[model samples]
Target: FPRRRRRQAQAPLSPAMATPRRVPTILFASSVAAEQDETFVHSLGLNGLLELIAADASFAPYEQTLFAESALQYSRRMQTAEQNGKLDRRVEGFLNLLSAHFLSQAAQKALEYLLRHFRVHRHNSASLLRCILPYHGTRAFVRVAQLLRGSEQRGAWLRDGAGRLTAPPPRELVVGRAAKDTELLGQLTYLGAAHRVAASFSAVALLEIASRMRFTDAEAPLLRSLLEHAREGIASETAPDRRLVGMMLIT
Candidate 1:
């Protein structure tokens, strides 16, 4: 009876005063239990995350790792190795974590790691550039574009200090672009999975990559090709395809 009065006298919870918290979205088949995931992230840190990733072939670990925030020290191991612009094979697992619904600390860490080391090791990171765009959907403008821009800005410079400046051999070109580009954007728009969703997603990604490398002042083949796709997508029976075209127009 006395305890009941004391409990009732305590301050009521104020909606305005409560702290905001992250609401997790399902990214995999199922998520680990809340308490278990919290322990995984805060107790074991990033090493725990890597272990979970290695253990699960499915992307189930992302629920606990990508959306969960860890202290900065957990990332120390990645720091020393990446400091030298080299990454270990085991560390490459972070690539799977990049396909996030919204950019969280975990996603941001993976992004920064990739961009920071992209200049030194392009082949490893560049191979997956096309896949990154579709996962982010409209956020491709922010995440994928930022990644491409940073990689190009940091690595695309032609260095020739001795006055004998020569172009990098053809092998150095970004994926989907070439020394003398053949223009893959047109082909990519219609060449992927037959389903409208998959085709549209892949097409949008290729368009972004191709658009990035296009001549600054000169744009023709791509322009005409783009109009064709836009015309087709806008008139498609699929609502999602039409929506994709609308996003493409503004982007």
Candidate 2:
């Protein structure tokens, strides 16, 4: 007699897994979705993503905001579904688990790796720098300084008297290192989060980095403001341990 085939049971999908997979990675000034779709980024969850971006230091503010909004909306939708009984009770558990997994040290390492290898178009770098400045202020400051320095080394200098001595060029020049320096200086001056992150620096580090950069006379005020803000920040925060570290850095 032939034995009857054994029946197999399929594992059920968690409710979170049933949510929409596609999410816009970046939100622009026009509220348009970026061409790049981060379909799998949602698996990281909201707080998990916040941790990742905080550590990664590459996602601009708009992108970070977009990720945050998208994650929040998705989570809300899931909560609603659970309330409505459209999804299994396991969805909440899955979300909690996802957050746990992404917050692990291993997940942080993966994010760092992605940051190091990720490349954006040259034209986009300035905008990216602008976005990251508020979230990772001191690091972004150093980065912009480095860009200015590199541009200076590449001969992007404007003759101090040339513009004052004669009429300005017909159009904004975008030809050489001077143009690059000008653009970078403008970016550095306008960075939104500079004051917030200024205090993280030891006074010495701030001075040293500032002196090393080729900021023009016109940019002095911005540099001075950042330095002053940083000093004030260091003074107001009373972390004795870090204060000791700052002294060590100073020495």
Candidate 3:
């Protein structure tokens, strides 16, 4: 007779396997489906998110929502920074980065909007020039020059009581000084001395001053040079620092 065959024994399952699978299958299924639709899903890209954020009336009530979603996403990123616990310094740095980026964009948009919709009156134009005077970069100065040019184009005329004929006002009637302030140029020179500098605000300021002073095209090239230099410096810096400087330069 043949020797008795030995029976092989199977190993039992582990205790861990005995329990039901704990994943929330429904949640994962929804996420997968949502990802399939590009329009339905929110993108993290800067431009896309800015468009979404700007679409909301709150962020850009006066101007077109060119990058609303991106603005909203930036705000959310700020919140995330607040919640992050890994490094306290990282949180502050991230917050600064976000603030700088958004604020600069906002200021630019606001300036553009004003240029399109609002007429710069003598008083308001003076105030605007004051704001721009300390900051002497090309973009700002160019816009200022445009405003000043507009004023000059309109001429210094006043309507009569019957609104028939008008005559130019006396020199004292003008809102701002006729020429660019010497102090502003000095300040620009000082700021330009810095190695890592941005001049968005300076540009805006220069534009405003030029506009108020009614600077000729011949005079604007100097302001434009400052703006170009500032932009170059900003571009040369590290990514986060660039954002910070851009914001500071504009604001």
lDDT of 3: 0.36
Q: What stretches of model 2 exceed 4 Å from their correct place? A: 1-39, 44-205, 210-219, 239-251
Task: Give the best candidate by TM-score.
Answer: 1
Pairing residues by index, what is the TM-score of model 3? 0.23
What tens digits encode model 3's per-residue C-alpha lDDT throughout 74-129? Answer: 33235564433332333222222222233254344433323322222231343343
| Top lDDT hit | 1
TM-scores of all candidate predictions against the true structure: 0.28, 0.27, 0.23
Candidate 1 ranges with C-alpha deviation above 4 Å: 1-58, 61-102, 109-121, 124-218, 235-251
lDDT of 2 by residue, 113-159 (tens): 22222221121244433333332223322332222212223212322
lDDT, model 1, position 26: 20
Native-structure RMSD, model 2? 19.2
- Per-residue CA lDDT of model 1 for 1-251, tens digit only, reads 55554445757669665544322222211223222343333334344345444544454544454324543234434566564333334234445333432244444434433333232134343323433434333443233333233344422322235522143222123323421233334334443333444466555554565456455445556555556666666666655655465357536
Q: For candidate 1, what is the TM-score?
A: 0.28
Local distance difference test, candidate 1 = 0.41
Candidate ordering by TM-score (highest first): 1, 2, 3
Model 3 residue 33 CA deviation (Å) reads 42
